[model samples]
Target: MLQNEQEYIRILRSRLEGTMPHEELDDYLSDYREHFRIGKANGKTDGELWQSLGSPDNVAREIRVTHLVKKAEGNRSARNIFHAAFATLGLGLFNLVFVLVPFILLVVMLLMIFIVGVLFAIIGPVAFVFSLLQGGLPAFSSWISPLIGFFFCTGMTTFGLLMVIGDYYLARFFYHVGIQYLKWNISVITGTECSA
Candidate 1:
């Protein structure tokens, strides 16, 4: 039996706290008032009609919750896309670093290893000549020196490959973890229930 439309809008605004669209709030209040009038014609009091529609607080809470859930879902989609793009960027950067720097480093390291191996090969012959002249136990063990150089070069090559693979996998794992953390935080913050 509310006579004034403005009074009804004021009550709804106080309850909704500016969360719902103003036009929608106006429509909903108009509908509720019409329904209340119908209930009044059917012998219900204003209090009875209000109670049947639900507590104003509960109605407001439901509207707020629905709006927030939709907003959260929209935000979640945006964040997912953003995180995916960022992760792709991170992976791209990781690939660029590993491919360019490691490729260059591997080439330099191999060149250095080749130079050292050649020096060792030359040293073996030089030591052999010196040993023959000095009559000392072959200054460099002829068989052992080449074997040591070969194994050292092989180990360095293996280690360089492993480091590149490890870098790729580590970057992938951290990017996935970071995306999951962002998703979890968004859900927690946006899923909070509004008080009635």
Candidate 2:
């Protein structure tokens, strides 16, 4: 049916009711309400306004994806990010290569960095102990100085810790960027750029 402002608002509210909080739902609906109000004030009919706004279902989907991305950003969970990415991927075929490939590569890169950091963290202590033993054994001490080995082990441990910390920040940065890109993608894909 989707002929008038009330019907448009009702459909959006019903479709998004369970997925979004009441306050947030009201906030989004208000935008449409304003669009309708302004259009009517300018002498446009309800049908014309509704048509220009596009389908309520499509609008609902865009809002849903945007909300999911925001939720993932706030909570920072694997499940949340997966849901957000999956939802965005559903928007268009281009996302299959653009979104999915980059996501996979970034995840693999982060995991590899984490594993390397853990290996270094473990090996650093063992190396430190071995270096101390070298001082006690004159033959081993001739091969490498205990003091030099101690510094090297310390440097490895410090670098590993920094790598782990840096990875965390980098993940957060990418997550933020991903969310913004998804928002833009949804806007463009759905032809709701003005509303977005």
Candidate 3:
């Protein structure tokens, strides 16, 4: 179906209006209007400009991803990044393999490490108490001296804290890297332009 200038703007507005701030939405619309005005001045029709820019839906999808990615970067929140990643996935089916699978694996790995860190942090104090009590934990009290156990528990707690801290830094690193990758993917790997 052929789209006129009005149809193109309408489609973009419909898809993206609620998802971003009004100023941003107006900026996008203004840019498209400029493109149309320039094209028309050069003796090109609305259809030609629309075709060059690609279908409004695909273009809107790109805009949404860009908006969400910027939000993620600005806020550094997991929810924002997650929304951006999923929006990137919407650009094409190949992203199911290229983006989603790796994202899931990375998230699971991070979560596992976090859980292990928390378990160690909790167990250290529990084991410390057992090691000190009269009827302490059977295995630890039987073989370990109280002073040694105290040191061991302290070491365990410290290691856990370090792990937790490391995990946080690692997550930040991944988040930064992921945002860059998503920017590249949306521009180079996904449909930066489309036809209608």
- Give me the candidate number with maximum lDDT: 3
lDDT of each: 0.55, 0.79, 0.80
Clashing pairs in 1: none
Best by TM-score: 3
RMSD (CA, Å), each prediction: 18.0, 13.7, 12.5
Model 2: how far residue 102 lies from native, Å: 1.0
For model 2, the superposed segments whose C-alpha errors exceed 4 Å read 1-92, 134-142, 194-196
The residue-by-residue lDDT of candidate 1 on 126-149, one tens digit each, is 554454554542534444454454
Which residue pairs in model 3 clash with each other?
A: none
* Candidate 2: clashing pairs of residues: none
TM per candidate = 0.33, 0.50, 0.55
Candidate 2: tens digits of C-alpha lDDT, residues 1-196: 6499899999998777756577998999999999999999999999988888889988898898898889879999876676677677675566877778899999999989988987887777777886676662243455677776777778888888888888899899999988888776654443233243
Q: Comparing 1 and 2 by lDDT, which wins?
A: 2
Shift of residue 56 alpha carbon in model 3, Å: 4.4
Ten-residue segment with the worst summed lDDT in candidate 3?
A: 187-196
Q: How well is each residue in 2-100 modelled by candidate 3, as lDDT tens digits?
A: 678989999999888667788999999999988998899999998888889999998988898888888879998776676777677674576778889
How many clashes show up per model?
0, 0, 0
